[model samples]
Target: MSLSLKRFAVLLLALTPALIAARTEPAATLAPEANQAVTARMVYGLLSDSRYAYAPRQLDAALEEDILRRYIEALDREKLFFVASDIARFEGYAGKLAEAIKGAGLEPAYDIFNVYVQRVGERVAFARGLLDAGFDFTQDDEWRYGREEAPWAADTAELDALWTKSVKNDWLRLKLAGRDDEQIRTTLDKRYANLERRVRELRSDDAFQVFMNAYAGALDPHTSYLNPRAADNFMQAMSLSLEGIGAVLQRQEEYVVIREIVPGGPAGRSGQLQVGDRIAAVGQGRNGAMTDVVGWRIDEVVQLIRGRKGTDVRIEYLPADAGVDAPPRQVVITRDRVRMEEQAAKSKVLEIEDRRIGVIELPTFYLDFEGRRTNAADYASATRDVARILEQFKADGVDGVVMDLRSNGGGSLNEAIELTGLFIEQGPVVQVRDASKRTAVHGDSSGAVAWEGPLAVLVNRASASASEIFAAAIQDYGRGLVIGEQTFGKGTVQTLVDLDRFARNENQRFGQLKVTVQEFFRISGGSTQHRGVVPDISFPVTLDASEYGESTYDNALPYTEIQAVPYQRLGDFSALLPELDARHRARAAEDLEFRWFSEDVAKFRAERARKTVSLNEAERRADRARDEAQREQRQAERRAAGLALDEGAFDDDGLQADERNVVQDVARQKAAEDRPDPLLRESAAILVDAVDLLAADEGRLAARVLRPGRTSTVWAGGADR
Candidate 1:
């Protein structure tokens, strides 16, 4: 039981024959395979000794308490299964994890989880019985769905009452989804059984993964522990077939949440799959019975999801904006390989009357590393693709350009920097601060400018990482106007370390650690950690920043700043914002599309704030009818205005088209072209306003970067359009 750093796998957990796809009942005993103290010591040593972590600290009494608290919260999210007595009984483990880890004395993690399993088993049986008792949907009662912040129940009686409502809520959801009483009974009964089975099937390795993750999460939300079995399963899946409903899944509390949707993938093509949506159940084909994956291990969930191409997979999910009490909506995605072309930067011109505003849609900051290394002539690079588009825009004599980054979850860091370089002639783009307090300036030294025209960068809550870097660089240098919602505030960089690399014994398997090693900063010095790049002129957004962005994570890093770097200032968007905002607001108020978008956003915002739902059948049905009528009314308006197809066969506000029907596709595409995006048009309008404003006051405008001794200003011609 030595706490030596050299024995990296000293705390490896005993494994069962379960290869992640099986759900057999566990054998009698769950035991440890190696020394926890030695493994903990090694893992901590790597963390503390890293030259990059934000602030790796010792496992002192204070940190130990936080770790224990995090572990408890992870096990009993929503405070459902655990009673006040259970938590009180585990209080002795508080401020004791550090000592226990160092001395190989920690038994509290397993003990608490064991208690959790028993509690879940009891709750499951009670919930199943509640279904048999039958729910009275006629009652005008409200069911409280979210209880993450609620205090633990004082006694089992209180817990039973809570479970009763929870079970009722479940039954009501199924009924709303069109299930009959018998069908709802059977479905809910199976769901409860699955929950119980999942809890009982928690292997020793699964416990270790959860406990270590709690420690990591106490430090920062981005920090994580990836168990070896899960990693192996993913690798095997990737090798076997590159087919699936392409959505990145991550374990959050008891549910698996969608982290990102791969462009051109089945999930993205379906358009219903969204980032932050929680997966409740999964099924194969069109009508297969869904297997409850609420509390299943991530690998098991993955095994069910990734399958052969052209296969239909139904995913029942809680919408990103919906509360836990909301009825689950399912989407059937036909799985296929992701097409890289769909992810590349593409261009279009919004020709409204006399103005031709060039728009470039960059879904991600992509770079073909292999092609670049091999010097492949046809390789795809965001910078290169965008540069080409800018050249075309110039050739077409466009008025302004909008770099659309909405829903663009970032990719390559180098691409962000290089893309930033395209607009600015040779300057620092972003800065990186390592754990050792060493700052490195990463910039573009290409000494070339792609486009010097009036520019605007559009962003949203889903625009993160590399997207933030690009938008922040553009905003910091006054290079462009950042418009729309504040970006996803993910500024830290992480690297995965395989523990097996340090293990002396081949059989001793440790997991992998994803450590946050650095932070991203704009050239202007502000880190885009928790506080993302705020839009210069904002648009109406339904997503609450506190609930949707990095701020949602309790352990996200704080915003900080370093010394500013030297860069030439372009035109000042701040000075023109007052007039620009006034005009924009006036236009938005008058525009029918903008008004409708705002109305929808308002409705979603209201729905998001609802913590409880009416159980009354009449009330629920009335609400449903009202919502449907509203949607139908909007559809009618679109048809009346010729914004929709003449046949009225298309919905989705003319945003999506049926590719299979060529005639309908062309009509829908035409309708889509006719239907202008309010935000994008507004952004282009702002950029145009900036151009005019700059022309009115040339003294404040520096459209071209002037070198110390070079005064050609040749790039200034890009603004002439």
Candidate 2:
């Protein structure tokens, strides 16, 4: 229970686990050789449990040492302008860490670089060793680290050379710490004296957990492996209510890169933050001093950014395309409570073909977990509000509705069921099965139908989780038309478990675990695991086609199907497919924006296919030319959307009136045109056809209901149910 250890836990949790993956459960018990202290034992158990699922090969002690040495050397060689004095100060911290680990019988510092204890220590060191041995590490190499061509080697000479260099570096580092060369060398020799004793006292479970953590992190940001203990901790995922900055930050290369900004998040509202912005520093409150964040871990940086709602957080950012020497600017933003209203489905009217088409963009099925626990408004309440909006659109005489679930990651299973119910008349939404094989079916209990009009769902590469389920159900039930890019393929469900739930002391902090428990299947019996929910009609969008979907991920499960349940269809809307397709094609061909998009896709396709890059200066110049062409194409896209053409004007300094004016003009023009979104125009025309068919089919029931003797009494005000 030291201050640093507590800080470590807080910061560690801040680091998001790599993307989801299928993994074997790790051992649950603590290692036999774990430290006697409860906290140390918890750390030891986690490291050895394999629950954290660190990549074993990469996190070996020897590997970590090597990687650490190389990373440190790189930092020094780059001369990031760190003075010699700073090195001494850094070494002082390292010395203290080593001492603490020894006194506590914890193997904290495994390598000279920041790859301290846990699984990363070994993998990074081994990779560095390979590099030092004059081995070629290329894409083709079998090993995760090192050149693909020379992935594995049986000889020890090269590896030995690397270890020798690492040892010399360690010695030199110690010498510079005000220790005489002899004393430094002696200390180094003495450092190994207790190695055997420490190893014997080390817990195997801790080692295993550390291994899992390292391995899992190497994948993408969402995948992870959980041990049984951790799995059990997250039975009821707690929802917290807080205003989020609305930006997705990830560790990319050596920097924390902004992946995407939620359209209405505080960050998104400010319009200063964008995908690919690099955060270099953060300042607290209004007028707080900025703290430099270079070389800091992703989680640590996140901790600094999170605070009480209604507070101001100042961020310093460098644009993605900025040069190494480019200066960054500060953006002071006020954080607010992020609620469903901010991240939920927002409606707009798009006129494409002289028809007013209703466009509802759903960001996520987010239910405030913390609020729900405290009996606050839930996802169902938010969906009800969205339903009200949809009704208003219906009353407004909109042609059709576009339910856009482009980048939604999903939240709240109950909300998913309720939302589905809002679209479809009383039916089962989804089925959930526990580990013991018991099944629970969730249904639409309200019998409330929101809008039964023509519907088109828009999705893309980033859409996943509940997004897939809703889209699949809609497609399976023939309730709507799916358009746009392919959906992200994730059909699995995860349960987050807190390890400390069953352990002693919550603050003892064993950490929490998220484990896959069940897989979702469509009513038609098909699983949206690897294949995802395919759009009925696909659109040519961005180059993300190559960069998205579960198919491109490693260790992804295969798609499967079960026997589909029979549900009577209230009506059919597919009869107008031919007319809809033809109309859409014609509109797209004539629209300048669509034409621009088509051309850009074609030009980028050719460039994206070139995998090899020439090292020659002349050839490099050709590459630059290709890149510039791509940029120009993007610029033209902005103009097509009625945006400002000045590149410098888009910088983080501030927004220009021209930019805002262009955006407003585009929206206003689209509004005035009053064209049904070509996509929805076709949907409306089909719905109108369905209305005709319903009238034709009602020959018997209509006759009976309209009979003078069997007239139904109409109440002035009544509840049908």
Candidate 2's residue-wise lDDT over 235-330, tens digit each? 212222345476656653335667666667788899887666778899998788999886566666777876667889999988867864799977
TM-score of each: 0.73, 0.54
For all candidates in order, the CA lDDT equals 0.73, 0.50
Off by over 4 Å in 2: 1-211, 214-342, 377-385, 436-438, 541-547, 615-721
Task: Highest TM-score: give the candidate number.
Answer: 1
lDDT of 1 at 265: 78
What is the Cα-based TM-score of model 2?
0.54
Candidate 1 per-residue lDDT, tens place, 436-519, comes to 778999999988888876678999889999999999998877777899998889998776576777666465377677788888
Candidate 1 has which clashing residue pairs, if any?
A: 10-35, 52-435
Q: What lDDT is reached at residue 236 by model 1?
A: 37
| Total backbone clashes of candidate 1, pairs 3 or more residues apart or in separate chains | 2
